[model samples]
Target: MSDQELFYLLALLKVDGVGDIMAKKLLTHCGNAESVFKAKLNQIAAIDGVGSSLLKKIHDKSIFEKANEELEFIKSNNINVSFFQDENYPDRLKHCIDSPVLIFSSGNINLKNRKLISIVGTRQITSYGSEFCKKLIEDLVPLDPVIVSGFAYGVDIAAHQFAVENNLQTIGVLAHGLNQIYPKMHKKYVAKMEENGGFMTEFWSTSSPDKENFVRRNRIVAGMTEATIVIESADKGGSLITANLANDYNRDVFAVPGRVTDKYSQGCNNLIKTQKANVLTSAADLIYILNWDVESKSKAVQKQLFVELEPEEQKVYDFLLKNGKEILDFIALQCDFPIYKISGILLNMELKGVIRPLPGKLFEAI
Candidate 1:
C-alpha cells in the first residue's frame, strides 16, 4: 500500500470505536481508509454499527498525529508492514474476522506453501511438556513446518527453540510492539530468532505488553495456523484460550493427554473429555488427523509395527478389519462402545495407523 493509505489506515485504527471488524466493514463500505475520512456523516452512518460517537471519533484529528509518529518509527526502524489484504499477510490469518488490519513484523520469515501449527501451553512448562515439544518438532522436521507461538516462557519458547534447532522457520507473535520485547530476560534470544524466523505484532510502537494484549495476541496464534496443539496447561491459562479460539475458527485442536493427577494436565484432560480437542498422544496423531501426508510408507509401516492398542481399541480395529469398510456408528454399535467413546477410540486407532478414515464417516483397517 502507498504511504498515504498506510497513514490513513493507522489513523483509522486509532479511532475510538473502530476495531478490526468495524475497520473492515468501513473499508468495505468506503473503499479505503482515505475514503472513510472523506465520506459524509450520513453516508458513514448508513453502515450498521457506525454510530454518532464513532463518526465523531473519526473526525478527531489527533489520531492523525499518533499515526504519523508511528509511521516515523516504521520508517526509521525498517519495520515491515503487512496490510491485511496484501499478499504478504498470512493466508490463514486473513480469514479471521478479528485479525489486525495491519501487522508489523521483522525477520526473514517465509510462509509460502508451508504447513503452520501453533504449540501453546502454560508459562510454567514441565519436563514432560518440554520433551514432548522437542520430539514433536524433531519428528516433524521432514515436513519443515513453521512453528508459531507467543514468544513467552515455557512451551512457547521451547517450540521456537526446537524449530530453530531443526532449522525450520519459526515465528514469535509478540504481545507488545516490535520496538521492545516483553519478559526482558528473553531479549538474549531475539537476535538468533530474527536470523531465520522473526517476530510479529499487531501493537504499534506506543503500545505496551499489557495483560489484555496477551489475550488479544492469542487469537492471532490460533487464527494463523492449520492446527493448535496444547502441550500442557493448568485448568485455566492463555493456551486454553488459544485452543478455544482455534475451535471457534473451525481449525483443528489437539491436546497432549496426561495423568489426571498432574496439575498441568487438568486443562488438556478436560479438553479431551469435553470433546473440544483430539487426543494428541504423539506427532503421528497430528499427522494423521491433519492428513499431512509427509511421512514415507516405510517410515509409517515401521511405526505401525509397534502400534499397541488398548483392548477396546483392538476390538474396534478387529471389527473394521472383518467388515472391510464400516460406518462410524456401526463400528461403535458392533464394539458395544458408546458413540462418544467410540469417536475417541477411532481417532486413536487412526493415529496408530491401524485404520484409515474413508468418505461418509467410514473406516477401514489398514
Candidate 2:
C-alpha cells in the first residue's frame, strides 16, 4: 500500500466505534479509507450499521493526530505492517471476520503454504506438560510445520524452544506491542527467536500487556493456525479459551488427556469429555485428522480395522455407511437414539477412527 493509503487506513482505524469489522465494511463501501473520510454523510449512512453517531465520530480531527503518531512510529521502527488483504498477512487469519485490518510485526516470519499450529497451556508448566510438548514438536519436526504460540510462560515458550531446537520456524503472538516484551526474562530469547521466526501483534506501540488484551490476543493465535493444541490447562484458563475459539472458527482442536486428579489436566480432560476437542495422544493423531500427508499410512486406520465397536456405535456407523453423510440430528433420529446419546456415541466413534466429523455437524463413516 502507498504511504498516503496507509496514513488514511491508520486514521480510519482510530475513528471511534470503528473496529475491524466496521472498518472493512466502510472500506468495502467507499473503496478505500481515504474515500470513507471524504464521502458525504448520507452516502456513508446508507451502509448497514453505519449510524448517525458513527458518521459524526468519523469526522473527529484528533483521530488523525493519533494516526499520524502511530504512523511515525511505524516509519521509525521499520515495523512490517500487514493490511488484512495483503499477501504477507496470515492467510488463515484473513478468513476470520474480526481479524485486525492492520497488524504490526517484528520477525522473519514466513507462513505461506505452511502447517501452522498453536500450542498453549497453563503458565505453571509441569514436567509432564513440558515433556509432552517437547516430544510433540520433535515428532512433528519431520513435517516442518510452523509453530505459533502466545509467547507466554509454560507450554507456549516450551513449544518455541522445542521448535527452535528442531530447526523449525516458530512465531510468537504477543498481547502487547512489539516495542517491548511482556515478561522481561524472555528478552534473552528474543534475539534468537527473531533469527528464525519472530513476534506478531495487533497492539500499537503505546498499548500495554493488559489483562483483557491477552484474551483478545488468544483469538489471533487460534485464528491464524490450522489447529490449536492444549498441552495442559486448568478447567478455566486462556488455553481453553483459545481452544474454544478454534472450535468456533471451525478449526481442529486437540487436547492431551491426563489423569483426572491433576489440576492442570482438568481443562484438557473437560475439553475432551465435552467433545469440544479430539483426544491428542500423539502427533500421529493430528496428522491423521488434518490429512497432512496422504501417503503416510495412519496408525489410526490400522487400529480402526481391529477396533471393536459397541452395538450403538455400530448402528450409527451402519446408517452412515448406507446414507453416505448425515447431520447430527438426522443420525440421532434415524438410529432411534436421543440427541445427547448420539453425540457421545459419535464422539467415541471419532476417537476410534470409525467415523469422521465434518463441518455443520455432519458425520460419515471413514
Candidate 3:
C-alpha cells in the first residue's frame, strides 16, 4: 500500500462506527479505503451493514486531521505498520474475522515460518506456576518456538524472560501503543525484548492502556499463535478471555492443572473440566497435538527410543496404540486398572515420554 492509501486507511479507521469488521467490508466492496470515500453513496449503502448514520460519519473531514497526526507519528518513530493483507502480518491472525485492519509494531521482529505459541495466566503468578512455566519453555527450546504474551506481570513477563534467557524470540503484545510501555516498571525489559523479539499493538500513538484495551489486546495474543497455554488463572480474568478467544479462532488451547484448593487454578481447572482446553502437563502434549517435528532435534525425541513402560503403563500404551485415542475412563476399564490408580499410571506414562494427554481426558501413545 502507498502513503496515500495508508493515509486513507488511517482516516477510514477513525470514522465513527467504522470498526475493523465494518472497515474491511467497506474496503472490500470499494476496492480500497480511498475508494470507499469516493464511491457513490448509493453504491456503499447497497453493501451490508452500511447505514445512513455511518455514511454521514464517513463524510467527516476531521478524520483526515487525526489520520495525518498518526501518520506523522509513524514516520517520526520509525514504527513498522502491517496491513492485514501484507505478507509481513501474522499468518494465523489473518484467518480471524475480527483481526485488526492494521497492526503497528517496533523492534527487529520476524514471524515467517516460525512456530508461535502464547503463554498467559494470572497476573499474580505463584511459585508452582512460575516453576512450571520455566520448565515448559526450557523443554521447548529445541523447537525454537516464538513466545508471545501480554507483557504484563506474572506469567507474561516470565515467559518473555525465559525465552530471552534461552535465546528464543519473544513478542510482547501491548495493551497500549508502542509509544510508551505499560506498568512503567517493565521499561527495564524493553531493550532486551526488542533485541530479540519486540512489541506489537493495534492501538495508535494516541491510545492509552485503559482497562477495556487489555481485553481487546487478548484477542491478538490468542489469534496470532497456533496454540495458547494458561499456566494459572483464577475463575475469572483476562487469561481466560484469551483462552476463549483462541478456542473461538479454532486454535488449540492448553491449561496447566492445579489442585482444586488453589484459587489461581480455578479458571484452568474449569477449562479442562469443560473440555475447552487440553491438560498441559508438559510441553510434549502441545508438541504431539500440533504435530511439530522433533526429528531433526535428536536429543529432544531420543528419550522415546529408550523409554521403558511398566506393566500397567505398557498395557495402557498398547491399548492406545491399537485404538488410537481413548478417554480416561475407557482406558482404565480396558486396562483393568481402577480409576484412582489409572490417573497416576497415566502421569508416569507421560513422564516416561511414551504417551501424552489430550483434551477431554483423552490419551495417545507417542
Candidate 4:
C-alpha cells in the first residue's frame, strides 16, 4: 500500500474503541481507512457495535500525528509493513479474526506457497527437549518447512538455531518492536536471522516488551503457520497459550510427550491427553499426519515394481495393495501386528519403495 494509505490505516488502528475486528468492519463498510475517516457519522455508526461514543472518537486528530510518527519510523529504518489485505501479508494470518491490521517486519522473508510450522516450548528447555527438537528439524529438512518461533530462550532459539544450521528459513515472532530485541542476550543472532528468515511483529516502535505483548505475540506465531508444535512446555506457560491459539484458529497442533514426572513435559502431556494436539513422536509422525510424504508416492510406487519385499513387508504390502490406502491404526489391526511394530515395518517398506505414508495416518502400498 502507498504511504498515504498506510498512514490512514495506522491512524484507524489508534482509534480508542477500534480493534482488529472493529477496524475490519469499518474498512469493509467504508472501503478503506481514508474513506472511513471521510464517511459520514451515520455511515460509520451503521457498523455493528459502533456506538455514539466510538463515532465521536473517530474524529480525534491526534491519532493522525501518531500515525505520521510511525510512518516516519517505517521509512527511516527500512522496515517493511504489511497491511492485512496486502499480498505480502501472511496468508493464514489474514484469516484470523484477531490478526493485526498491520504487521511490521524486517529481513529476507518469503512464505508464499511454503510450508510453515511453529516450534515452541518452555523457556527452561531440557536436554531431552533440545535433542528431540534437533533431530526433528534435521529429519524435516528434506521437506524444507519454514521454521517459526518466538525468538525467546530455550526451545524457541533451539528451533531457530537448528533451522539455521540445517540451512532452512526460520522466522522469529517478537513480542516487542523491530527497533529492539528482548532478552538482549539474543541481540547477537539478529543479523544472521535477518539474513534468511528475519523477525515479525505487530507491536509498534514505541511499544515495549511488556507482559501482555507476549500473549498477543503468540497468536501470530500460531496463526501464520500451518501447524504449531510444542517440543516441551510446563503445565502452564506461553507455549500452551500458543497451542490453544492454534486450536482456536483450527490449525494443527502437535506436542512432544515426555515423562509424567518431568515438570516441563506436563503441559505437552496434558495437551495430548486432552486431545488438543496430536502426538508428535518424531518427524515421521508430523510427515505422516500432515501428508508431507504424499508427494513421493508416485516415485515410491515406480520403485516398488522391481524391489523384492520381505515376508513381513510383503504381508503389509499385500494388505495395502488390496486396501488401496488405509490408516496406520487400521493397517496394524488388519495385519495383526502391534501399532508400534507397524511404524518400523512401514519405514523399512518406505525405504524399499514398497509403500508410502499419507496424511492423517493413512498409508498405501506403492
lDDT, model 2:
0.88
Best prediction by TM-score:
4
Q: On residues 229-257, what C-alpha lDDT tens digit does candidate 4 reach at each position?
A: 99999999999999999999999999999
Which of candidates 1 and 3 reaches a greater TM-score?
A: 3
TM-score to true structure, per model: 0.82, 0.81, 0.83, 0.85
Tens digits of per-residue lDDT, candidate 1, 190-277, equal 8888998899999999999999999999999999999999999999999999999999999999999999999999999999999999
Candidate 2 residue spans exceeding 4 A from truth = 294-366
Model 1, global lDDT: 0.89
- What clash pairs does model 2 have? none
The weakest ten consecutive residues by lDDT in model 2 span: 294-303
196-307: candidate 2 lDDT, tens digit per residue = 9999999988899999999989999999999999999999999999999999999999999999999999999999999999988666567667877522323444544377
When summed lDDT is taken over every stretch of 10 residues in candidate 3, the lowest stretch is: 293-302
| Residue lDDT tens for model 3, 1-366 | 677988999999999999999999998999999999999999999989989999999999999999999999998999999999999999999999999999999988999999999999999999999988987887787678999999999999999999999999999999988889998999999999999899999998999999999999999999999999999999999999999999999999999999999999999999999999998876656777787755445344456556777888778888999999898888878888765567667655665667767776688887
**Poorest lDDT segment (10 consecutive residues) of candidate 1:** 294-303
Assess the local accuracy of residue 166 in candidate 2 as a C-alpha lDDT between 0 and 100. Answer: 89
Local distance difference test scores for all models:
0.89, 0.88, 0.90, 0.90
